[model samples]
Target chain A: MTLTLEKSPLTEAAYYILLSLYEPMHGYGIMQNVKVMSSGRVNLGPGTLYGAISSLLEKGWIISAGESDSRKKEYQITEFGKKAVDCEIHRLEELLANGKKITGAKQ
Target chain B: MKHSTWRWISDYEKEEKWLNEMAAKGMSLYGFFMGKYTFEETEPGKYIYQIELLENFPTSPESVAYLRFLEDTGVICVASVFRWVYLRKEAASGPFELYTDIDSKIKRLSTMKNLWFTFVWLEFIIAAANLAMVIYGWLVVGQMAWFNLGCVVFLVILGLILLNFGLKPARKIKSLKREQLICE
Candidate 1:
């Protein structure tokens, strides 16, 4: 799957959300995971996360992993989603590497 | 004991802030219908209140799913007025917010404007019709033209008021888009 982070980077909310949904998880689960994964630095509001979920679903990066009898629906990342995350990671790493190289930290 | 208060705030953010202020003052909003807000006494700052304008009726399956998702996140759906949903969370819940990112915030504002765009325009339409009635009565019919003139006056003012409310969010969205551009 071709992935691009060329035009606009994913919002910080969407990035953390996609990362949190490696397993099939519901909204609350994703929220907690993002908070923990970000070292308690990022907290998502329901409205923001809800919008991100809808946008990601529309883009086909994620799919609703069949709702259980439980009322809370779960979502899982598709292969496309994994590729997107990988692409974002590559972009972030490039920035990091370039910063370190210019700062002469790479001796 | 429950007490009810009336409000006519057009801006959602201002309405939300007023609800939070009431919560902070120890009267928590439990329900809202029309322009009336019902509150029950609670400990000061006991709850955090949020309000959102859903893209569809609150009873729709999509909105229901969204509310369920919020409920799972410890946000309770307290009341709904048409497309507007009132949410509450115990203050103990860490940092309750409904929109975290700028894009989502812009989307929220857009949805807010959409929900009211029809009504605002309807106001203008009614005012325009009344304006025509006023002119027709004064020149052609010449009876009770003053009544049509009164209707035109009232509706024109109300239309302008609602139109201003509609424009506020549009302005907000434009500035937010600029901010996103700079951040990008």
Candidate 2:
């Protein structure tokens, strides 16, 4: 599938969310995982996370895995989300390689 | 202590800011109806309030599910009136925000604009109907012309007020769109 970063660039929060959902996780669990994965650089506020979750769900990139408890619902990234994440990774790698070449980081 | 306060605020920012300030002053909002707000005295600066403009409340399944999701995320919904929801979280809970990104904020503001736009059109229709009735009273009925004209004037004023309310959200939505474009 043709992938364009302009058409599907993942927000920092969305990227981390997809990463966290490699395994099914509840809302709070996903939040904790994102924080750990980002090394405390990204803190997902409840509102921000909720918005990302809703958008991802609407795009069919994520599916509800069911309730984890009496209160929280669980979610997992779909095959669609996995492909999107792969595209984002490639885009980021290209950006990094181009930046390193221009800046003479290895020279 | 429970105290009832009456306020007529059409702007969401102003209303939310006012509620937060009151909370900072030890007044936690309990509920709201018509123009009245019931506040309960509590520890000063204990809670932060966020106001959400819902298109449908308490009836729509989506609205109910949205609220449930928010609750699962630890936000407390204190009250809802018509299409407005008053939410609160502890002051120590980081921040009480409903729309963290510009796009989500724009969406929230757009909902408010839509609601107000509906009011503006409905009021316009009512004002036009009242004007027609007033004209009929003056030309055909030849009775209570002054009373009918008074009603027409009242309807026109109400329509103007609703239009003003709609304009506030429209401006907010415009600024949000501009910010999003610049960020991109």
Candidate 3:
């Protein structure tokens, strides 16, 4: 299935997970990085991360990196993942723009 | 010192909570088989426990790979009974949670509900078969198999118990679905 933002919006947990994968990290690293990137606002649980990684990998948005001699498997975001991220960013920008326009809120 | 205890907890969520409570009191669970729990002495509040209903038998390769992934996240698989895996991580390691969002929670609960529902139906069918055979022996045939009536009674009771077990998770899934709508 095409994981396009227009088709189905990304959950906050999923969005942060893909964002954290640009650095090619393992499971625990991804969880920690997501937590830090979101300023501790988003804590990705182990089970949720496992499920998201499996889905993202199946969707061709991420690829498993070669084993780094450690038991932990690493993953890196692919071009498809970047494309998905871009699509989501545009959608989010549109949401912000429309909300601000109506609320007369300052950036 | 190792401590062993037996507690039959039907609901996974309540079992997880009870295990965590035991961990907070310095009893870290290290083994579990069926309803028996084995714990080892540890520092108070040193660990957090989580239980999951696996999609297949825990010994299956699929579940093994899944558990390996969880281990990489600092959660170790302590034990498994059938499809139920018992996991724990040190409480010193920030915070540990198996599910962070409602979607995954709902999915897990649905899995549990479906499993119980299957068992309930299986038991119910067996009870019906036994009853039919008993009637056939008494009327259609010439033998008196009144003793089989007792077996049918036992199976029916077991099936009813399982039906009750299935309903708890079904209710949980229903509320979770409502929460999903509100969140969206």
Candidate 4:
């Protein structure tokens, strides 16, 4: 099935997960990076992290980088994932722009 | 010291809640087999437990890979029996949840509901066969049919119980899916 980028906005959890994968990182490293990058606002629980990784992998947004000696597998985002992030950023900017116009707030 | 207890439970929500309550009281899951849960004493509320229901048993290669992924995320697998996998992580490490978004939660619930309904249909088929056999035997065996009737009755009852067990999760899945659609 063709996935439409317009149907659903990127969730904060998914966005951060994709963001953390700009470099190859293992599962635990992804969780830690998400927590730090979100300024402690978003914490990806193991279950949530697992589901996100599986979904992204299935969507061809991420690929396995390799496995460490510890048997922990690492993942890195694909070009598709980078495009998805850009689309989300554009959508968010539109929302911000519309909100500022309505509130007559200068930024 | 290793401690063990057995519980016959099919409902996932109840089992997850009960296991977490046990963890809060210092008995954390160590392993499980059949209906027996093994625990090693740990600090109260030191661990958080999460359960996932799979369509196939845990021995499958897909399931093994899935569990390995969770382990890589720092979650420990405590036990797996049939289609249910029990997992726990130190509470101090962070939240012990596996699903943080509604979409993933909905997908998982749907998978479990489908599994339950498959069992219900299988039970239904057995019940139908039992009734047919009892009726056929009654026509041919004359007065020796009471035993067959008793057997058929027992099968029917068991089937009904299984049907109820299946329907509960099916209902929960429907409601959750509806809620998810509404949110969308």
Candidate 5:
């Protein structure tokens, strides 16, 4: 589903977390993705990760896809979550283009 | 809607054993077990108190220090400070009235020693005193006095703010008590 660019409002951490879960991922997998994606600039603690996962679940942005053994549960983004991600990407591209234009003008 | 009241030691070991025994006996109990001591009205005149979760209380160095300080002070000690405990069948009963036998005013004072309450009051008091000093110095003592007063006030406010923020870790000790009471 195509998402419009107006309704995306989330913190950078939340946005990155949802982005990381494009494929089926578990808690640790998401944590690892975030670390690699940010080049270690954003290291989420276990407590914070758990809290973020719960909030995302409550918002219906993510759902438990399956469990890998009893210890680790994998999750996947919903169609709504994908739309949100698309919206954010569009917004970010606009920001980057605007920033480039401003910097080019300065030069 | 029945409840029972009893006294148990506020010490961590004894309280844990008692809670285990109570659980084993198939009783559902919930309430805080607190020990409190009021120091003499000297420079550091204050009351020291500890609340232990009857089930999983912490036995750490800081807890030991608090208990020891109470013992050394020779202050009046109140123990087995549970308000109400219920049986398993009686668990969903409504809240019952639980009163401390101590004077209400004195008990109210004890609540002030809580970190949140103390920190708020400390900030207000320091702010008020500093404002007073600033106004008084400007009117009477001159700019030098005002500058001196400003320096003292700044240091005092900064110190109190740091102390207030530092008290957060100690709040963790209270969580241990809460965990013990929470029925899981």
Candidate 6:
């Protein structure tokens, strides 16, 4: 039997965060970048960022980089993270293409 | 009639003197000498001695002489001394009772609050990080389209997992919290 995979809707905030980590960024840097990127739509608290970072680490999507301080840890996305992003882009493209075709047909 | 026997031995010397005296009068000095003595005046003129043994008392002439002197002074030795092990079996139900009632209640409240706080905090951070990525992607790394896509996908997975975990039934979480609270 073929396994049916369900895709979830990406929250605007999460969508933008992954977008921020193209470079090696620390917690504070990530927070600042996200704020600027969203045009002040999302502000990440330290506690919240820490939790997300940990989750990302576990999922193997992000790997730890050299420490910024004794307390602060830096992270960068892994190859797997890059692949996931590619997949998401393809999915988004397919949806867009399908939408265009359907709308074009109606016209 | 119910009678109360309360002896205040303010001075250790006086208490020793009284114990020595009773031991001289054919009272097995073991009970009184070993800090296992219990006194209860069941009647107005009589006191019951139910002594327990914690350690071995010294049997020496000096101790015997002290006992003799006290016995000669008309102190009555009412009971025979018996040797027993003071078995201190703690009430098995005591800690469990504490755990279930006081410990469990406090733990549940604190844990629920903590879990909720953690869930909210995680959600916020994931949201914030995602926002940052978007802005940086647009401004700094417009050319790094591949990397930007990866970050988005990773975050989407993380968000879904977090939301699922946060929304899952909190019964197990509640129990774990209770356990931690009780232990503390």
- For model 5 the local lDDT of residue A85 reads 83
Residues B1-184 of candidate 1 have per-residue lDDT tens digits of: 8999898987778889989999999999998888899999999999998887888888899988888888888899888987888899999977787887787889899987775677788877888898888788778986767877888888878877777778888899999998987762
| Candidate 1 docking DockQ | 0.70
Worst 10 residues of 2 chain B by lDDT: B93-102
Ranking by DockQ: 3, 1, 4, 2, 5, 6
Q: How would you class the docking of model 1?
A: medium
Model 4 per-residue lDDT tens digits across residues A9-104: 887778988999999989888888988887887777666677788888888888899986787898999888899999999899999999989888
TM-score of each: 0.87, 0.85, 0.92, 0.85, 0.39, 0.33
Error of 3 at B68 (Å): 1.0
lDDT of 2 by residue, A1-107 (tens): 32223455788888899999999998778777987887877777676688798888888888999888674789999898898899999989999999989888667
lDDT of each: 0.85, 0.81, 0.86, 0.80, 0.51, 0.48
DockQ head-to-head 3 vs 5, winner: 3
Candidate 5's DockQ is 0.01
lDDT at B159, model 3? 86
DockQ of 3: 0.76
Worst ten in a row by lDDT for model 4 chain B: B140-149
Per DockQ, the best of the predicted structures is: 3
In candidate 6, what are the lDDT values of residues B65-132, reduced to their tens digit? 32232233222233233322211111221110111222233443344345545766775676667667
- Model 4 has a DockQ score of 0.61
lDDT per residue (tens digit) for residues B90-135 in model 4? 8887777787667777777777767766776776677677677777
Give the candidate number with the greatest TM-score: 3
- Clashes (N, CA, C under 3 Å) per candidate: 1, 0, 0, 2, 1, 16
Worst 10 residues of 1 chain A by lDDT: A1-10
Model 6 bad stretches (over 4 Å): A1-11, A69-71, A99-107, B1-184
